[model samples]
Target: MSKRVARIGIFIALAMIFSYIEVLIPFSFGIPGVKLGVANIVVVTGLYMLKPQEVFFISILRILLIGLLFGNVMTLSYSLAGGILSFVVMYIFKKLGSFSIIGVSAAGGVFHNLGQIIVAAFILKNEKILYYFPVLIIAGVVTGILIGFVSDKVIKTLKIQDFSENLK
Candidate 1:
């Protein structure tokens, strides 16, 4: 139990570090809300390597920590929505076990954007926000694919399944 708790702590820290690194890099593609979502690499890694409950816990904890450390209320709202929705979609896909990691991650990226946009629309009370949906979707796919490939390599190279057994 302590090992699992320690692992979750480590994952949350890594996710937060990645979030900080993302903030350091000025990766603007002329889009307002687009991000490389480098932090999601840790989330995806958790999905592949940990149980669903653990992944959910880590995702939310990372978001909360990032919010408290680096963001404001609006950031928390948007990120909480996106993170929870993305986690749900990814969990479903993981359960289906039909899609490749890339597919699942891509779906998660798209859904995350959608979730945040939805929150933005609600907060701003402007349906025009939907106009950005298509572009965000494209960005999501690109970032998601990139994160997915990196995660796949990490999972394979590290032999996450074998490592999971040791954790057990």
Candidate 2:
């Protein structure tokens, strides 16, 4: 239990750092609310390195900490929606067995955007936000591919010989 908690803590820390790093970069698509999703690397890594439940646990911690540190209550909806949706997609990818991290992360990106859209629609009580879908999907493609590629490189360099190898 302590080991799992420690892993979750590590993920939260990395996610916070990446989230803050993104804030400093100030890069955005013209679409109002889009980001590079740099912190997703940690989520993707958790999905690949541990069980689905463990990955979910790490994700909840990361999202909570990241949101608390960088955002207020309103922004929490976006992160919560996006984080949960991406985690689900990553779990599906984990089940599929043959896809690359890039593919899986791309899926995560799409789901993340979709989740935010869902939340925006619910919170704002408007369906027009759905129009932002295309731009969000494109942005996801760009960011997700990059994050996944970087994650793959990092995982390779870490030399994790098997899925459970890093569990210890």
Candidate 3:
């Protein structure tokens, strides 16, 4: 139990670090809600190594922590919506057992953007925000593929199967 807790702690820290790193990077597509989402590398890896519930917990915790430290209410709300939606999409894809990490992550990224756009439209009471959906979806797929590749490498390097076995 302690070991699982410790691992979850590590994952949260790693996710936070990735989020911070993303903030440092100036890469942007001039589209709001479009991002490399490097932090999702941690989420993708966790999905493969940890239980779904544990990964969800870590993801939500990371979002809350990052929000408290560097964001306001709006940011937190957008993040919560996107994170929850993306996690659900990714988990479903993973459970289907037909998609690779890249596919699952790509779906997650698209849905993440969708989630944010939905929130934006709702909050601003303007349907114009939906116009950004297509661009964001493209960005999501590209970034999701990249994130998935990195996650695959990380999983292979860490021998996550072995770690999961040890935990079991």
Poorly placed runs, candidate 1 (over 4 Å)? 160-162
Colliding residue pairs in candidate 3: none
Give lDDT tens digits, candidate 2, residues 47-77.
Answer: 7676678778777877787778778887888
TM-score of each: 0.95, 0.90, 0.94
Give the lowest summed-lDDT range of ten residues in model 3: 159-168
lDDT of 2: 0.83
Stretches of candidate 3 off by over 4 Å are 160-164
Per-residue lDDT of 1-168 in model 3, one digit per residue for the tens?
Answer: 898899899999999999998888846767665778889999999999999999999999999999999999998898999999999999999999999999999999998888888998899999997888889889889989999999999888778456656655
How does each model score on lDDT? 0.90, 0.83, 0.90
- Number of the predicted model whose TM-score against the real structure is largest: 1
Per-residue lDDT for 33-87 in model 1, tens only?
8988888999998898888899899999999999999899999999999999999
Pairs of residues at least 3 apart in sequence or in different chains that clash in candidate 2: none
